[model samples]
Target chain A: MLLAKIRGTLVSTQKVETLDGLTFFICEQLDIDGKPLGKYVVAADSVGAGVGEVVLYVTGSCGRYTDTTTNRPCDATIIAIVDMLDVDGKTVYNKTDDA
Target chain B: MLLAKIRGTLVSTQKVETLDGLTFFICEQLDIDGKPLGKYVVAADSVGAGVGEVVLYVTGSCGRYTDTTTNRPCDATIIAIVDMLDVDGKTVYNKTDDA
Candidate 1:
């Protein structure tokens, strides 16, 4: 799993049928400090995460473990909503701090 | 899918039963020109990719798309062995060139 922030949404009208009804979010990869790393991923929303929300995303086949992605072609999926992030015993991100 | 080079192998004696008989390989992420970027991933071998071979790996739910990874907890899986890599219509890596 990796830390990322929801950047935006992706509305694909012509994706494969297996991806129907799955919501997609644009997530920016974040470093341990919660800073953006300029890399972006389009992840299936399995946890109802909204834009600007910090999330923990799992990639590969783990993305398919959820009901929304089962047997789907998704390679990235947001698995958890992060309320706070602690790295090396330091609180790096707190969702309540968002403005 | 992303390009990567098999670096090493991982043997686990206590992994979940769903992962039994699955071979894991350490893969280094590769750039378009086939240079290692120093990031590593442990991928379940869906294909019989050998060490030092370049492969295309799929992450997240797509990793489970293969028969070997179906219903497994695998997140990254090697899908194909690369015979060559063409970047911008230029040949960057050729398996025949390996000496």
Candidate 2:
């Protein structure tokens, strides 16, 4: 799992039937320093996460472990809503800090 | 799926049983221009790709579609050994060019 911030949503009316009922989120990967790593992924949203929220996403076959991604073609999925980030015992990010 | 080049291998003695019999390859993601994208992933090799070979890898649930990755914890898997890469009708990468 990696840290990412939900950037936006992807809406597609025309897609494979297996992809139906899946919500996609455009996620910007974040480095340990909380900066964008200049990489982005469109991940299926397994959790009801909102835009701008920090999340943890799983990739590959493990992504299918979520109820929403089972047997789907999804390669990425937001699996968790992050509340805080701690690095080397130091708090780097805390959701409460956000107004 | 994404484009990547196998860089090295990873051996682990301690891991989940599902990961057993899985050969892990360290791969560097590539951009459309065939340049390294500064991202790396440890992918399970579904295809017989070797180090220095450019290959296509699948992630997420699709990564599990392969016989070797089914119901496993893998998130990335090399799905194809690329023979050529055509970008906008031009071959930017060809395995033959490596020789």
Candidate 3:
């Protein structure tokens, strides 16, 4: 699993039939310091996260193994909305208190 | 390599020195049909990609291999800005011509 932020949303009217009714979101990976880590990716939005929201993501087959994404042509997914983060014994993020 | 759409961006003020000055973006994986495939991820933005742009991303150790991301804790990165996509024989996206 990895920590990231929702960057944007993608809407495609034409695509594979198996991908119908699914929502996709772009995510920017956050380093331990919460800085933009110079990287980006497209992911399945399973957690209903919006742009600018911090999130947790999964990759590979684990990302494809979900109720909404099972057995599909997907490699990434937003699995959770992160409320806080504690890394190396420090409060990196506190959703309610920080914002 | 995989096909994705840039969703958003992330900015952090504190983090590992190695991760400084890097940009992270949110991404949603796209299926062959150009629909949201119900998956999302955080990727390091190697290219100057913006929201709503289609991009190519790499994963695993390959993602961490770059001038800005070498020897860091990362799993994904956007390697290129996708100008078009053709899967199983179809024009899903053509940047210059499509909106």
Candidate 4:
């Protein structure tokens, strides 16, 4: 799992049949310090993360373990909305701070 | 899965027990044009690729789906050795040419 920030939503009608009804988000990878890494991924939204919210995402086949993405060709999926991030015992990011 | 060039081998004796007996390779990711993408991954070798060989590597949980990597904590695995790579109707890479 890695940290990312939701940038926006994606709606594609002509996608693999199994992906229908699942929302997708445009995510920018974030470093531990909560800064964007400039790399991006389009990921299926399993946790309903809003734009600018930090999320924990799983890539590759692990993305399919979620019930909504099971057996799908989905390569990335937002698995959790991060509430706080602590690195080296120091608080780096707290969802409440952004709220 | 993506294309990568084997750069070297990796041997870690103190790793997750499930990863024992699996050969690992250091790989550099390649673009469709066969140029290095500047990203690297340490992947378990499933196909016995030698250094400098172009191979197909799968990342994430899919890496654990292979017989050699099943139930392991591997995040990457080389699945196939590329014999040739063609892009835009042009031959981009050929193993024989390198040999």
Candidate 5:
């Protein structure tokens, strides 16, 4: 899994049939320090995360493991909304601080 | 799936039991224009790609769908050796030419 920030929502009606009813979000990859990596991914939303929320996402076929994306061609899926991130015993990000 | 160049092989004696006997390779991501993208991945080799070969790799759970990686914890797998790459009606790379 990797960390990202939900940047915005994406709505596409002309997508593959299996992806219908799944919400997509534009996500910007985040480094461990909660800084943007300048890379982005369009991911299916499984956790109902809002824009500006840091999230944990899984890519590749593992993205299909979630109920909303099961057996779909979705390559990225938001699996969890991060509450806090700690690395090396130091707090790197906390949702409360941003909220 | 993505394009990558096989840079070298990897040998690990202390790895997860499921990953034992699997051959790993160091791969460098490649752009559509056949240029290096400055990113790298350690991938399990399923296609017996040699060093310096351009290969196609699959990440996530799909990496485990192959016979050699089935039910393994692998996140990346080299699935195919690329003979040529074409984009926008132009040949971007040809393995024979490189050879």
Candidate 6:
């Protein structure tokens, strides 16, 4: 899992039928300090995260292995909202720092 | 399968509960002349990508294995939609030049 920020949204008109109701968001990978890493992804939002929200996302197969993505064409799903992140015993995020 | 770009998008509403209408995007991670090597992701669109376009994603479990991401819970789902991408041999992208 990695820390990232919600940058924008992606809109697709003609796509797979199963994707019909599914929403897609534009994301950018972030560093430990919550800085833009400069990579992009379109993931299935399993958690209710909005723009500018610092989120925790899973990659590879874990991203799609959700009840909502079952048998759906999805990859890179937001698994949690990430209230706080501790790396090497350090508080990278506090959710109260006022971002 | 690396090379990526997209900017943001993440909207969660209480999450889980089978994730109502799965969709998330906010990616970063690009090189190969595309620039922006930041880290970020949240994907689930199978095609028809917008927001600066330039898409192509896949992760761990084949980005949810396709067929609409079998077994719910997705991973990383954009299986196709890259008009032209070639590494080593050159030509990173060629949807008709000019990005």
Which of 2 and 5 is the better model by DockQ? 2
Write model 5 residue lDDT over A1-99, tens digit each, in one string. Answer: 999887655433332345568776657789999888967666779987887889999988788898877765556789999999999999999899998
Candidate 5 to truth, TM: 0.54
Interface DockQ of candidate 2: 0.10
For candidate 6 chain B, which ten residues in a row score worst on lDDT? Answer: B80-89
Model 1 TM-score is 0.54
Location of the lowest summed lDDT over 10 successive residues in candidate 4 chain A? A82-91
- What would the per-residue lDDT of candidate 5 be over residues B1-99, giving only the tens digit for each residue? 566889988887988998888889999988656678899999998766789988766677766766678789888877667666543345667777889
| lDDT of all predictions | 0.76, 0.76, 0.70, 0.74, 0.76, 0.64
lDDT of 3 by residue, A1-99 (tens): 888776655545433345567776667788977887846667777766777788888887576677887754456778898888888999988888746
Cα misplacement distance, residue A77 of candidate 1 (Å): 14
Residue B56 lDDT (model 4): 98
Largest TM-score belongs to which candidate?
6
DockQ-derived CAPRI band for the predicted complex in model 2? incorrect
lDDT string for model 1 (A22-44, tens) is 87665778999977896655678
List, residue by residue over A1-99, the lDDT tens digit for candidate 4: 556889999888898888888988999988666778899999887665688888766677767766667788878877667666554345677777889
Candidate 4 chain B has its poorest 10 consecutive residues by lDDT at: B10-19
Model 5 accuracy (lDDT, Cα)? 0.76
| DockQ value of candidate 6 | 0.14
lDDT of 6 by residue, B1-99 (tens): 343566766788997665466566676756545677767677765564655555667765665555555555656555544445443345556655735
Give the TM-score, chain B only, in order for the candidates: 0.96, 0.95, 0.87, 0.94, 0.96, 0.31
